[model samples]
Each structure stands twice: as C-alpha cells, then as structure tokens.
Target: MKVSIDTDRCRGFGVCVSLCPEVFTLTDYGYSEVSVDEVPADLEGAVSEAIAACPEHAIETL
Candidate 1:
C-alpha cells in the first residue's frame, strides 16, 4: 500500500503519530508528516488505522 499526506489539510492532531509513530511524525511547524510516502508491509494495519482516525482527512491510501 502507498500512503500520502496532504500537508495543507493536516492539523497536527498527533493521532497518526500516536497510532503509528514508526511512520508518522510531527513537523517543526506543528503538522503531521509522513516519514515515507510508501507504506511498508508490516505497518499496513497501523497506517490504515491512522488514515481512518485522521480528523482532517489528510491521509490517502493507494
């Protein structure tokens, strides 16, 4: 699976970070940032949950 975050739509809620710290982090500007554009096989479930929990709907999976 591939994941992408829309930085403009992100609110830095940290939900994704809490759910999947391995893949997400908080930027200095206070927005949620993806550590990588592509989701690794082992982290698919966590990443999917993060996508679902995103309040701003800034995460997309492909």
Candidate 2:
C-alpha cells in the first residue's frame, strides 16, 4: 500500500507519527509527512490506524 499526506489539511497533531513512526513523521515545520515511499506489509495496520486517527484526515492511500 502507498500513502501520502495532505500538508494543507494536516494540523501537525502528531497522531500519525505516534501511531506509526515507520511510515509517518512530523516535519521540521511541525506537520505530518509520509516518511516511506510505500507502506510495508507489517506496518500497514499501523498506517491504517494513523489514517483513522488523524483528526484532519490528511493521510491518503494511493
């Protein structure tokens, strides 16, 4: 699975980062960003949780 973060919608809540550090991270400017090119099999569940937990609904699957 692939995921991308919508910077404009992200509020830097850090929910995604906390749920899955392997796939998501907070940028220097304090925003969520996708750290991986593709979601690993083992991390897909965590990534999905992050997507659901994100208040801004910034994470998207591709």
Candidate 3:
C-alpha cells in the first residue's frame, strides 16, 4: 500500500514516527514526513498502526 501524509492537517505529534520509524521521520517542521511512497512488505503492519495512531487523521493509505 501507498502512504500519504496531509501536511496541512498534521500536528507534528510523531505518532507515525513512533509506530513506523522505517517508513516515516520527523521533519524540521516537526511534523511526520514520509520516507517512501510505498511501504515495504515488512513494514505494512507498522504503517497501519501509524495510520491508526494519527490523532490528526493526516495519514491515508492508498
């Protein structure tokens, strides 16, 4: 699956980074930033958890 982050809606909570560090990182802006467009097979579960943990609902799976 592909992961997308809506920066406008992000609150820089770091939930995504905590849940899926392999797929996401905190930018200098303090919001979570995507490292890759598509998630690797091994990281899918973590990514899903990250999406669920996002309080701002900024992450979307496509």
Candidate 4:
C-alpha cells in the first residue's frame, strides 16, 4: 500500500510518528510527513495504526 500525508492539514502532533516512525516522520518544521512512498507489507499494520491514531486524519492511502 502507498501512503501520503496532507501537510496542509497536519498539526504536527507526532501521533503518526510515534505510532509508526518507519512510515512517518516529523519534518524540520515539526509537521508529520510520509517517510516512504510505497509502504512495505511488514509495516502496513503500523501504518494503519498511525492512520487511525492521527487526530487530524491527515494520512491517506494512495
């Protein structure tokens, strides 16, 4: 699965990063960004958790 983050909607809460640092990361400005273009199968569960945990609902599958 492919995942992307909506920077404009992101609040930099780091929930995604905290839940799945392998797929999400905090930018220099502190916003959460997608660290990978195509997510690996092993990390899909964490990615799903990150998506569900995101208060802003900024993460999406592509």
Q: Judged by TM-score, which candidate is best? A: 2
Clashing pairs in 3: none
Candidate 2, lDDT over the whole model:
0.92
TM-scores vs. true structure, each candidate: 0.89, 0.96, 0.93, 0.94
lDDT of each: 0.89, 0.92, 0.90, 0.90
Full candidate order by lDDT, most accurate first:
2, 3, 4, 1
Cα lDDT tens digits for candidate 3, 1-62? 99889989999989899888999999998988899978999999899888888999999887
lDDT of 1 by residue, 1-62 (tens): 88778988998889999999989999898887778877889999999999999999999876
Q: Candidate 4 residues 1-62, lDDT tens each?
A: 99888878899999989888888889899998887878999999999998898999999899
Question: After superposing candidate 3, which stretches have Cα over 4 Å from the reference?
Answer: none
Worst 10 contiguous positions by lDDT, candidate 4: 31-40
Looking at model 1, the pairs that clash are none
In candidate 2, what residue range of length 10 has the lowest lDDT sum? 31-40
Candidate 2 ranges with C-alpha deviation above 4 Å: none
Report the C-alpha lDDT of model 2 over 1-62, residue by residue, as the tens digit. 99998888999989999999988888899998888898989999999999899999899999
Give the distance in Å from residue 38's predicted Cα in candidate 3 to where it truly belongs. 1.6
